[model samples]
Target: MNRAVRIGVQIQPQHADYKQIRQAVADAEETGVDIIFNWDHFFPLSGDADGKHFECWTMLGAWAEATSRVEIGALVSCNSYRNPDLLADMARTVDHISGGRLILGIGGGWFQRDYDEYGYEFGTPGTRLADLAQALPRIRARWEKLNPQPLRDIPILIGGGGEKKTLRLVAEHANIWHSFSDAATLARKSAILADHCADVGTDPAHIERSTGVRALQGSSPDDVVGDVLDAGATMFTIGVSGPSYDLGPVREWVAWRDEYNARQG
Candidate 1:
């Protein structure tokens, strides 16, 4: 089945109180976003180096109860932070809480500060990728062995653009592939992903293409969104940060999504 265009909002949990963060999630859902995401990190990715930040999965558990209609997950969880089987159990519990609306977006660990502060080994890029490769199957296996299964077969969304290992993992395991690439790079990487899918015997079309967009409220939809769609991306995410989480851009993107999906139909 061809995937429909969808809008996702990532409410960055930095420099904000839990009250404000909770409100942002509610507002995004109320504005009609299809998915709500938060990043997995120990500290702020931007702004002050020592800013207020919240942990990922625990916040996701809260979102599962707080939200009713929007799918919720991390934009991409760092694989090194938690054990594979434990992560699977956490995801499964969240899935049940959300009544089956979880998307397990994960990636090989980055951000050395998170590793250092948390006492996890800050390995080389290749080592991290190899760890992720080994973890995916274990996560899946644990999901099956859990006493109470996940409310649904939770969708796996993998984020990264490495043509060799990351894209290969997308082919072998991901139901969705998220990347931060422009149209040309997206097109090139997508072709590489298709080849990887062929090697794994998985249909490339089965993996939904996701990418990040910025300032959706300021751009002409045709010029900004049309190009990415042309490049084969259908899930467009806008990330907003801080104490005052804004939903104005999210509403605009939701409108754009409706218009685009109508046109596709």
Candidate 2:
């Protein structure tokens, strides 16, 4: 599918109170972001390590009821945190609440602190990836068996750059592939992803390429964003957090989204 360039914002649910976080979501939607994301981690990923932090899926459920336009989800929920079937039901429920605008961005568990504090096993990367590989199919099967079903086919987003396994999962299952990859890396891995798609009998062009704005490298005329676009990224996201959730970057990227889409037209 030929998708228009889109802008997303990850409203990091850390170092801020819920009321403040709620307002940030409102601000992002009003600024015209295409998607809103929050990550799945038990505690703060930056700043004060013990700062105020909220849970992921619960916040996403609230976002479904709160926002009227922007698509909402986790930047990447840890697959080990919840059972695949339960997670699928939770996603279906949120999809209904959002009127079918949920993107189920998930990945193998990371950040050992979340695992240790939460009393879950902080398994090795290999174990975590294996578990994630097992979870994806079960998630889909459960999605099919749910009452009322998802309002739409929930788009799956796999976030990771592991060549041997993560990219293979993306090729086989994902509708979107997000990574913190630079243009050269994206170009190379996208090719690898294509090879995986070929092996899995999936279409290489069907997966929409995504990246974080800060992950992009280069200081060109377009700050190398154009290079990432050329390499296949259509969805670009920047993260905002805390005391005052700034929307200036969000607004700037929204404008960039519009310009890129218009140019495409």
Write down the lDDT of every candidate, Cα atoms only: 0.93, 0.91
Best by lDDT: 1
Model 1's lDDT to the true fold? 0.93
Clashing pairs in 1: none
In terms of lDDT, model 2 sits at 0.91
Candidate No. with top TM-score: 1
Instruction: Give residue 49's lDDT in candidate 1 (0 to 100).
Output: 83
Query: Residue 171 deviation, candidate 2, in Å?
Result: 0.6
